[model samples]
Target: MADFFPEEELLAAIDLGSNSFHLAIARLDHGEVRKVASMSEKVQLAAGLDADKVLSLEAQQRGLDCLSRFVGRLGSVTPQRMRIVATNALREATNAQEFIDKAQRILPKSIEIIAGREEARLIYLGVSHTTAAGGRRLVVDIGGGSTEFIIGQDFEPLQTESLQMGCVAYTRQFFLDGQINPMSFERAKAAARKEVTAIAAIYRETGWDTVVGSSGTIKAARQLLMQQGLTDEQGHITYAALEKLREQILKWKHTDDIYFEGLKEDRKAVLPAGLAILMGLFEILGIEKMGYSDGALREGVMYDLLGRFRHEDVRDRSVQALMARYYADPRQAERVALTARTLFEQVADALKLDEEDGDLLRRAAYLHEIGLAISHGSYHRHGAYLLEHSDVPGFSKVDQLRLSFLVGLHRRKLRVETRAQVLHAGGQSLLTLCLLLRLSVLFHHSRYDQVVPTFVLSIIDEKTWQLAVDQHGAEWPMLQADLQQEIVQFANWGIELDIVQLIKAEIEA
Candidate 1:
């Protein structure tokens, strides 16, 4: 298997949420993921972001401490079968990579920062699986740094958006010092409303058969409403119930002074901000009621990971969609992809490239020429920009950037500086993959079924490679020129690329 990890094994997902960190472990059973264990900690990572959006040293330490505890509880889950995702806080933090570097030391898996819309899609996925799969539903999840709004039916999300307004962030902005006055509440509500206003028109027009709330904020609100007798036994948060909670919340002079039957000590500080955001959402989106769902982003990640095992990987679908949307030359893309995969197989073991790397190279090959749809000149750059910015679902922010970088490096004059930049981030494996992709793309430059000669790639060491191609292919003047240029390009990147033509004497009789 190209993938080192086995599918259908016990899988885990860790959500580095803005308000809290959550860990969930599950295993596939009868085509469904059955939860084995779960835990959460209120690290409140977003609360630590400074005005410059840098996570404070203190906050970083707190998060590290929490993950350390989680590490102990991880037991024996393989890192390959696990995924850790960070939400809005890390996305906003300028120094997130530094934090991630530190966190990766203590955790079993590398943390991936997901885009907000992707977060929305995952939230909806988790909700759909946990709830009934019928009718159109609007899913709202209020996190510490952002609020995600997703409209979908069944398991497919039609529209997903994330706004930079969340409980912890708003609390810091409007309810700092824990003081809560009607004016402060109004300000928080108004600010949240402004954020929602941008998408309200379309969301309202699209409408929904039901509204679903997921996340700690929504879950807490529902619990509080139920305990306060503001909501029915079913624990649904109605407009009337929301209004009652708002009135009661405004009665408190400060978060510290607030006392309610449903409030937890840890949730008190951020509840007011969360409530205000929900109030704004209710007002602007015309939501009559909302039911809380226990499933959320982490669950969605688990399902997505499971999908990879099930051969229904959404990333593949996303790649195909991009190819179609950009009017990519499917035939040429297939040729490049085939060539790339074949080249990958030749050096994957020596280069330490895994199945994931192979998948990445194939996808990059398929989408490499998408920018041609925009313009042939600098199409690589254009394609990179589109991949970098487009809302390709199922791709993490880092995944998009890596794909962008690969596409950017595919056809350009190999800049030692640019090569160094990629090495600094991705190290040697990425460079090797890029080399393979470049060769594959180069060999298929004719864009036709020119018989590609048999080739053998041998890795001399980490920094040196030798390629032996059939003399028949070497007969092509263009191929010879391309290979000569590639040798220079590889040298620029501090790697030796030696090309040789197979001798007729060495050919099998």
Candidate 2:
């Protein structure tokens, strides 16, 4: 966590957006970001995805080639200093992991694929923080594979929803022939309206005082509308401008012939589709106008990265929220966490782990039995599922996945024997984490008499861990059975667990 971008050190955000990939490098001055450099290429990776949601060879090459160029500008920045976020395209891709594996070979950084709602939240953060603080604002960002709509005030999102309608996907579905007729635009708008309709009721009920549109599509739209002299220099988009734009789009028979001033070359083909989605949003939600916003997800990612260092970690808050939501036993969780930390600290010298390891162990101990709230049987597995699948605001996609995997494999079965096949970089860490979690859980197997007995731990890599217990009450038989059952499970991780019942040198003779 300390490796977070030092205020003096340069920071960067690489957004693997649906339509294009962008790299932004900036310097922090008193917490405000001053953009030093920025680069974006129209990769159209979303369009490159096949029906099976697999990125084609040509598409992968295009993305990698663009990243290679960006890599040159990164200078001496480590992967830890830069945050890379992949959007809906990878989220939908069946072979995303393979693509990521190949990408990491060239980029030397792991990519995070954020969930849709989280994406919406980040977009809102960027918009809110960049813009002046005023009344509640509705922000809409139309991406290549997903469109995010968020209503926020004061840098906090009030309501967020991400839809599967976007420029690239809409272009493919509605304008594949490259002809932009009135009926074609109407149909595209209709499809977009259908997607938006699901959230219309809630959005209307929780209406924003002002509407702001962000992203390449809306920005381009606002620029074009300004060209028509329909809007002022503020770059406001209006419903009447959309009406006139529709008339002009209908006049142009084909997309190749359609040219609007200030429109980027790559945005040409998808412009119509993007406009249609925008039109749909306006009509369905009755948005009279929308102001253009300069910020979006990439900027938000940088702020989030910086926040982790400033001690306002959203991850910790998200974890605590989960425990509270699930009605987890606070007393049990705290006791287990303290006991686990004591043992971890005692063995940290022998184990060669760090404070980060301590934090993870503490969190895992605190929330180990949250799944028990769902059901008594297989609660550990259920808890794992919840952690893995839930949309946690402060955590990166991979971070949540790793935590979930640890929780899942805590007591039931060790999924660490096959390290070669492990998908995450923290496989060893997870195994160590699971060992501590299991010990904590087993220590408090009974609900009453909550004080955890003293214990000592010795680590022997992934395959073997030994525990020395100092006390055995009348419940010794039950605890022995529990610890022995864990030994068999630990073997699955290729580790032998040796439980030493070392009593203080005293016996009732």
Candidate 3:
């Protein structure tokens, strides 16, 4: 993990957890991140989950209230630089979009609800950066609603897993009765172990140089252990210390009553489940001792964000890697991109499309055919399918869906189903972009060794878009037919499509 970005920009990461919301602000100093400020609010978002996995009104308000305060602290981050990641709570919620829409309106940045495995990767990255970089390490981060485990050598993560075990969620399941007993403790520990069982064999095989832990739960546990004379000054969490802590926790008969030294009141109820999960991880993976790191997901996100500004963007690399892995046609894709961009410029003034659209259109054109790897039969459709299904690193699900839908609908006969998917994934703007992409693909469909048709396209009114095509040596009946087909297809997108031929004498008016 060489530092990928220049050290000029200030970076920040906000992790919206189920039990807590955190902000970590730091500046890149030499080759390391030096923290400027940090804050956490125990929002208990996971416990606020109702029977249907919907965040309760109280929980929603709590999150909103926290963001309102955080918005002030955000100060100067552009939407692109600041990353707001929601973990398991929004992943499980049916109405996450509702909350997301509200949050986006309040804040400058878009919120990314990452998958569990991605969360694990970032946790490892952050922990590795803050801890010693030598040797392979097993890192565990138990949060409010999910637990992440990773085995990484130096900075590169080898195995990543996220389990449905967390302090807040487990506390709600077992300790909500407020009458924790030996049976409840056993049940919580057993449940956590069951989740960890899925990855035990692989991680055991991969092994680790040491075991490390992070996050509030682990931090609290380390303090309690040291204060109780269970661990050393370096915060190496050992199996013996874990068992001793378990015994002490069981003696209380309730998480509330287990008041060991250095325990905070807010962490009192949730600490036992976190400890149980950590203990289960240690026993399952056969760990001797583990260190701790203050760095976790947020720190990793800040570094990643800075990478984008400094032109070391992981998203761009991920895209290029995916294209290579799928054996996509670079030359042909470039041709299409160039043609699409030419058309984009012609329409930019008329359509009022900004630089953002130009960038998006170019990317969509580059990846318009990745699904060919799956099958040549309707390869465009296949490419769309792969994009929507595969977890291309650095991409959110929504971004993949939109890109895939654009590629999927770029060709073939348009239908209502296509329109619905475009609308669902991207709404009205997506539908318009899909129209633009289809036109570009159609213009370059022949993929002739010659240059694609240069064209001017403009939105004439709220419902009408017109394309004026420049002659390419000779009139192309194939392209003309494609254009006629597009008129019908554009109707599906609720746009009136017009095609007009251009000659040198006629200024394409």
By lDDT, who's the top model here? 1
For candidate 3, the per-residue lDDT at 89 reads: 90
CA lDDT of each prediction against the hidden true structure: 0.87, 0.82, 0.80
> Candidate 2, clashing residue pairs?
463-494, 463-495, 464-495
Q: Write the per-residue lDDT of candidate 3 for residues 1-509, one digit (tens) a residue.
A: 23355466567889999889998877779968888888889998898888899877788888999988888877864555578888999888888888888888887777888878778877887888888786888888999999999899987788988889899998988887566677777788888878888988988888777778899888888888888888877768788998888888778866668686667788988977788778777777777888889889988777666655566766667678878989988877888888787777776776667765676677888898888888889998888888777766566667777788788888888887767867776676677677778887887776766855656677788799878776554546788888888898788767888887766665534
The deviation in Å at residue 76 for candidate 2 is 3.7
Stretches of candidate 1 exceeding 4 Å from the true structure: 1-8, 473-475, 503-509
Q: Kindly report which residue stretches of model 3 are placed more than 4 angstroms away from their true locations once superposed.
A: 1-9, 349-357, 416-424, 505-509
- Candidate 3 residue pairs that clash: 211-290, 371-383
Q: Quote model 3's TM-score.
A: 0.91
Select the stronger candidate by TM-score from 2 and 3. Answer: 2
Clashes of each: 0, 3, 2
The sequence of per-residue lDDT tens digits that candidate 2 reaches over residues 8-42 is 78888899988999998888887787678999999
For residues 1-509, write the lDDT of model 1, one tens digit per residue.
Answer: 33333435788899999989998988777777778988899998998999899999988998999899888867778887789999999999999999999998998777889999999998888988889775999999999999999999999999899999999999999998999998999999999889999998999888899888998999988888887688766677988888888898888899988887757788999989999999999999988889888889989998888777667889999999999999999999998899898889888998788888998999999999889989999999999999999888999988898898889889868888888778765777778878888898888888887677777777889788988878575436777788899899989888899888766754452
Among residues 3 or more apart in sequence or in different chains, the pairs in candidate 1 whose N, CA or C atoms overlap within 3 Å are none
| lDDT measured at residue 150 in model 3 versus the true structure, 0 to 100 | 89
* Candidate 1: C-alpha lDDT: 0.87
